[model samples]
Target: MSLLFVSASRTCRSSFSRQHILLSTSRFQSTQINPEIHQTQNQQTKADYPSSSSSNSSRRYRFYFLSIAAGALIGGAYTFRQSRKYEGLMPEYITNSEQLQRKAMEARPMPPPVTKHITFDEGPRVNFPFKLTLYQYVTCPFCCKVRAYLNYNRIPYDIVEVNSVMRSETKWSIYKKVPILVIENEEIQLNDSSMIISAIESYLRMPTKRFENISKLYQSVVEKDEKGKLSFNYPNKYFLVEPLTNERVDPTKQVQTEKTKDDARDNDATTTTKNVNNQSSPWFFTKFFSKSKSEHKEGLVNIGSGTVTDNETKSITSYNKSSEQYKLERKWREWVDTKFVHTLSPNIYCTLNQSLNTFRWFSQAGDWEQIFPWYQRWIIVYVGAVVMRGVAGRLRKKYNLNDNVRISLYECANEWVKAVGNKNFLGGSQPNLADLNVYGILTAIQGCEAFQDLMSNTKIQPWFERMKHSVEPHFADNRLRATT
Candidate 1:
């Protein structure tokens, strides 16, 4: 029975299933899926989701492009700013150059041939009765020269020794250099050595006779202008004038008192009669009168007699010609400033020595011990000597200078000796400008014991002795002697 039911079900199932499928077809169509739906969904997903490498590459490209643009903008802005600043500064530099050239040309024009005369009032010539006050250092060659010149001329001057380290005290006094000369009751303040000499000459003009020989000596040492005029222009750029307590009377208004021709002839006749009367006296009185007259004439006319008037002496103080002594001193000065000074360098052992000596000479005394107490004195001296020696050696290496400097110096020394030879002064019998000029160099060299030894051992000693003897007589202060 079960087999017969299975067979019958199988045959009926096929038929019945087909009939049911057909019956359910309408319901199935309402819920049926489109064939292109899956394909369209896949296409949208492909457009939205790319491979990881491709998306990363696109993001990196965009970021790189943005960064490059930003960097270029920053660089361009900086360059523009720098160029603008440079353009603004260039014109100022060019203008400054043009201005400097203009000033230099203006300063160097040829001076006029004849300077207009400057006149001053006359009186019982105010015997510039004041002593000059000078602040100086013995070691400074310039100071030594200035002082020696003043002393040689027998100019009334007082000196105040100034330590080199204490230069600040005089910073505002003059042009910040040594040999500052001050004259009382006068507004004159002289700084440069050359200028000081000129001022001295100007003041000496009043008592010219007394300085006649000295004036001549000074005139021999300077260079002259084409017009044969010797003028000393003060190097000071400006000067200050201070008010005087009293208003002095102007003497320019004074009337001249002249003798009439007949009156002058009568006076001459009277003077002759008096002379005749004196001649007729006893032989002893006559001799005394003659001697007195001779002495008076000698006092008025003689050089080195210490009686010549200032006016006579001043006529000789021209700047165009230099004295023989001045010529010699200048040669030495040139050698030192130009040749030896250029050779100094810090590499040599002698450099330390020079540095130490300079420190001692120019620095505070106490400061040396505080800074370099361990440095021996001999060490310091050695260093200084070596430094100079090194400098000399370098100069010898660099240039083939004329060996005549030493010879010329010696010859000058010899001449100076001969001029003052056996006499006490270079002024023949009196101290004069030549002696002053030469002594400046001599005094500078004399400060060093080694230099002194060198001079003494050489042919210079004899000349030095002559100068020493010639200047001794003028050392006494006659005014003080009279008071005593």
Candidate 2:
């Protein structure tokens, strides 16, 4: 029994040893296979990841390069557009520069030319009795009338020829217009022949010389107090003399009745005076005070009797006075300038021709027939007179002159002619302001042909014949010599 049990124990030990060996072999095989699997898995993971960060960085770089290229194209286009705009707008800059350069290259210098001098021989000092310098043109007819008047009265004067086309070196040079008279060295530029003559008479204190009949009539109509206080009567007989003479067989009877009616016409006269005065403000206190105090304190004081205190009050008052005077003066000047001048122009033209012809004949040494061929001279004169008359008519229409103003001007001119009637000038029968004034208008009229025909209707023709006889001797070319 003991031997069998010992054998069994040995057999069991052998069996356990074999099982341990088998387990060891299996562990070794498992370890080798696991190493191979792990390597394969790592490779697969690497393939799936695919280097994503590197790919994104490469795409961003490509985008940046593309953006820079597009921006460069846009900037180039913009610069080209700006260049084109500047070139189109300022073309002169290019054109002018070239022109200036060409002009500068072609420039040259020049010198002034020399001229000869003329000398005048002095003549004897004939004590010229006139105080006025009669500036006249040869072609003016009014100048002839003035000359006639002066010569008729045997007045002595210094005649200054003013050729409109010829310029003078004298300090007081006359305008292009003829008949500018200088009285006592003072220029009396008369636009109207009648006004000029009238002004001369006024200056010489002979207002009633032109129209003898009118002067006498006016004097007779003048109302005088027992003490010799002078006043005027309305609807005066003198004013109606022309109408009465035209209509009546005996004008003396009408004149007497008209003179007797003076007392009854007082109311009418007063009303007319008031109406005329109302047309414009009177030259009273208001005109003197209306100005700014700072500018005209003395003027205000003269107007207001020294009542103003504040600077503001004085200024206001002075301004009012100034405005009033300006209005009055402006109105008066306008009437004289337009109305008076236009009316007398026609009548003056007629008188001028007569005077010129008279003077020419009177002064000429040769027979009147030999002095000047009438046809040649008259034709030239006639054409010039016509154009002048047309111009005058057009001017009247354009300026809207009134007939009444013209009539008054005519009356004024008639008065002047009578005042200096037979006198050589305004200054006691010598060439004076009247001569210059009349000459200017006559010059303008004589420049045309139509005006010559108009003068034939008036007493101007005979007057001109007389004047020609008086002035012909002093002239070298009698036809060309100025009447004055």
Candidate 3:
């Protein structure tokens, strides 16, 4: 049993040793030559040596790819988990390095928005018809839309900031999306932002006891597809609901003549459109057709469709509703929802740094710091930015937007500017639904790089400032009271 082979002189480990070098000439075997190939031809069934070799090689390569992919995922997951230990604190290197000071500053999330309760006695400067409770993520554009409309119109409303991570505030609702405004009086829920505005505006105009009558117009049954996923449909959202009141019945008493109507339409659809291409569907939502439904991921709704009380009010005059000016407003509102909305993701989250900055604004504006633990905030900010960047790329391609992105953004701003023309807003003297829509969407990305660029490079800044001055402190106006 004590047998030993002869080593190369003294040591086999030496490179110059006989054992270290191959004693015989070596050659690689080719699959093209098989010992059995010569024995068998078309006369007999033969194994495909080359084919088998190629398949084996392909399988090995596939294994390598899977291994690398799996390793990367595992490594990323491990890193994320390990990062939880330092949730509130940055690593020493990041804190110490001056190069990463900005990033280090961004690591800390802003505190949640202030929570205030507004009761019925606390009426706004203007008479608001109802007590509304709006459930939203403060940074959501759709939520911002509702806010802008409410503020500009001098309506009183309550704010409930839903947690994007836990979403505990809105868990009671089936239709999960932001900008869910609850009409506290009739126990009714408004889902889409446009639909909410239309319903509320109609109520403000007519003061109907049966609010369900108007809200029901937007009611489309939620359909479950084969995948067991729910899809919400809102057809009448963009249409301005004509209030059924005797107030607008007589077209004969109208102030504008036919020539004035034609002039007004022409003015609303100003020639600024000639300078820009406004046809691209630039909305960032994946389901561009259902942009309202695929809006922000977390929010609230509790639909209580009560019976509509008998209101014998007559329909408005055909003159106002069927007017070209009305048509123009409706068209631009549709444009904002389908086209301008999509441009947001591409611009706001264009780069990782921009995305990070946006999410930081989100964390602060939505008040995520108080809602979730430090780790959740970290995941929401960093991981959410990464995911959103990928989404921005996809949205850019889906909408056929320009690679520069700013071009599409500028075109949209220009189109709106053109529509507004020589007036303060699209509604001539005041902001229309379209003006409010565009302004509100832009407001959500205010602190981001994209917004600064928009302000510096576009002509929309003046209009935006006016809109801001009008809509600022919307949630905390005279309408809101400190409920003890």
Highest TM-score among the candidates is held by which one?
3
User: 484 in model 2: Cα distance from truth in Å?
Assistant: 21
TM-score of 1: 0.38
lDDT of all predictions: 0.39, 0.35, 0.59
Model 2: how far residue 163 lies from native, Å: 3.6
Compare candidates 1 and 2 on TM-score and give the better one: 1
lDDT for each residue of candidate 2 in 219-261, tens digit (9 for 90 to 100): 2122333332323222221111222133322222111111111
Candidate 2 has its poorest 10 consecutive residues by lDDT at: 108-117
* Candidate 2 stretches greater than 4 Å from native: 1-128, 140-148, 169-178, 183-448, 455-484
Error of 1 at 215 (Å): 16
Q: List the residue pairs that clash in candidate 3.
A: 112-367, 282-342, 283-342, 284-342
- Cα RMSD, each candidate: 25.7, 36.1, 17.3
Give lDDT for model 3.
Answer: 0.59
Model 3 segments beyond 4 Å from truth? 1-114, 118-126, 242-322, 473-484
TM-score (C-alpha, index-matched) for candidate 2 = 0.25
lDDT of 1 by residue, 181-215 (tens): 65533333455565466445433321322222222
